[model samples]
Target: MCDGYVQCNIVALPEAYAADFARFCALNPKPCPIIGQSNPGETNVPLLGDFDIRTDCPKYQLFVDGSPTAELQDIRDYWQEDWVFFGLGCSFSFEDALLQAGIPLRHIEQDRNVAMYNTNIACQSAGPFSGNMVVSMRPLSVAHTIRSIQICSRFPAVHGAPIHFGNPKDIGIDDINKPDYGDKVEIREGEIPVFWACGVTPQQALRAAKIPCAITHAPGHMLVTDLRNAELATL
Candidate 1:
């Protein structure tokens, strides 16, 4: 597991809303492609095999009143009997695809989190879950940009294609250097910032609903699933 490995983005919510959220992901495959789910009262994700929703994630974010209150290493103590787990595709799975194909990412080299932003774009709501899309950014040359589009288009399980690129302000981001989440990287000369539908988009939806309580993997600390990235392709 060098540079190219499938990384999973995960979330766990009340079983009460799991079904609707699952259905919503089905309805909106591009933004939310759910790879696995766990039943109520279950701490393990069977689909992911040997995965513990509470401890598998390297970092956890506890949300109260729709806002993050603390970042923890594990959430076993807060686990609820009604909780359900969800595993979604992350852009990290495709980072290997990009690098193997010869694209260079500044943040990865710098060992930083991918820059994320809240866009003016609105997602189709499910029940009370709705909000503007959140996206992760990577800067690349024009040639690599087109090449990445072709490469990432094959992995629809993750955020499939670029929603927007170029000037960040157009996407409601005032400063590309100051990301709403994660650390920003240098945008090389002649390179434009590319945006992808982040798995974090679902968290935005969760916050908009103002759920009583919820938990999610820290932005970059995702679940390492049993399913391989190659197995996620439709073709």
Candidate 2:
């Protein structure tokens, strides 16, 4: 809900696995860009904002042994002494750049969550964390797609630019309408679906790691940071 600000994907896990997870993010920067993080047991990520990690995000996902077990508004009860939270750069941060560039996004215009899908593309493996990449799609005309690539390339910290455009099957997405996550939107007559490496890729990695317990921001529910989206632009 905080427009023009940076949004992050939350991934909190035990301190014991923090190094491996950090390495995983480093190896797969596009889908898991590390924006900010908190020390063990600390609920505050000063680098991101003056907010409490436990209660700041609108919704959180609880994962047990790589499987989602519950959804929560607040994670107070599940908080752990040795927990470490990593704030990953989110695609939402770059949408403002796209919008400002005059590139129309179908999902945004329809007031729906962007469609995300699992792809055949594999990420660099780190420890127990390894999985195929996930991507978010936006349908745009050829002109808009090219313009978006130019605009979004300036914001590399938030997934950079389009990874693939045109055929969904080129990236292993069997069906465009049946997304693995989020609502479906119309592709229109003259537009092609453009895909970007999504922050949700970490969740797929989390599931592969199969740590005993983990916490992540639910899809579309991100942590709003005090940082401005403009501040992240390289140009």
Candidate 3:
């Protein structure tokens, strides 16, 4: 029940393509770590334990015709027998680890959602799943920026390392102050923007695939899980 525990980003899709998506995550483990999974018609994620896949998550996205249809408080009504669940580690899971290491997160300090941008960098495609990578940004001093990358590198299961730093234009971002998703935070006199592989990467992929139907956890309202932050660390 620790707030610092890992919070996952879930994708419960029709079993016909679940395996393909899983393969996509496997191929790109940095952005999508498989922490828990479920077979067809099963609702529980044993790795997360005693979990109810339909409602344990804070919020959900319903996609119809490859576009977001509506937000749901809970998705029990849409649960299908042909569905399977895939749990990917969230960026929030590593924020606690970062804070513990004395790396202050600008968004958390400002009480805002992390800045996310849809990058021009395309992801490795799988059957019906291909899209640009989405990234989260935080502004910090140069020294702290390196430290954050070093600490995050230990948790490859949760977006192990930052994809890029410094120039936003290199990633196709036109403005450092304007983001495609989430809120922007002040850059301060000495801080530079740092980016990370975000959990929202899957959402970008889903949109590209244009799946007839897909379900995903909404931004910020991640699926809280039983895994502790320390448990996800690697040397």
Candidate 4:
């Protein structure tokens, strides 16, 4: 649903670990900004939309003891009474804004997902959650890059602004053409890779935490919420 509304990354876990996960997002707001959450055993996030968390998103990744075990279309079978769901603001919101402003997104133009990489930058630890930050990249000309920064800065909930631009090596990314997640889009002669804090940061933390069971949105397949992208902007 690449429409005018914003989409979100989903993280669902047992209520026992919910506080730790909440703290993780609080400590690292850049990458894990929480927009809404559901109470234990509840599948609805009224603040986002009238929908069931179990089947709203296009796809989900199931993790067992920190390892991704399966990818599924619906997670109804795995739902538990103690499950708490977190709806996180995703880069898709700001990407929509960038596209509206006429800033070219190579990934979209190339019919591919935005390139993402695990960064050497460490996130503030909170209980069982701690890992290197992950970022999504888009290639843009210098002029468009500046405009994108200005445009994105208004949406802090959805990872506002580029955290890094130009050198991929500075952020521990060895190859511009190779990404740790998502497909690689071409960076043209006058274009540079602009990186934004990505929602995948929590998945990295999940890997480190190794919780017994957890569910997260599959990369790039976000929950389409009724909330408009404009509603998330501060200015």
How do the residues 35-82 of candidate 2 rate in per-residue lDDT, one tens digit apiece? 998889999888788999999998999999999999999999998999
Q: lDDT (0-100) at residue 222 of candidate 4? A: 86
TM-score of each: 0.90, 0.97, 0.96, 0.97
Q: Whole-model lDDT for model 4 versus the true structure?
A: 0.92
Error of 1 at 54 (Å): 2.3
Between candidates 1 and 4, name the one with more favorable lDDT: 4
Q: List the lowest-lDDT window of 10 residues for candidate 4.
A: 101-110
| Worst-scoring 10-residue span by lDDT in model 1 | 1-10
Tens digits of per-residue lDDT, candidate 1, 1-235, equal 3234456777788888888778767776767888777789788766666767788788988888789889989988888898987888888777777877889988989998889888887777788788788889999888888999988888888878777889888978888888888997899789999998888888887787777888988876777766677766665
Off by over 4 Å in 4: none
Indicate the worst ten consecutive residues by lDDT in candidate 3: 1-10
Separate clash counts for every candidate: 0, 0, 1, 0
What TM-score should be assigned to candidate 3?
0.96
Off by over 4 Å in 2: none
Question: Cα deviation in Å at residue 58, candidate 1?
Answer: 1.6
Best by lDDT: 2
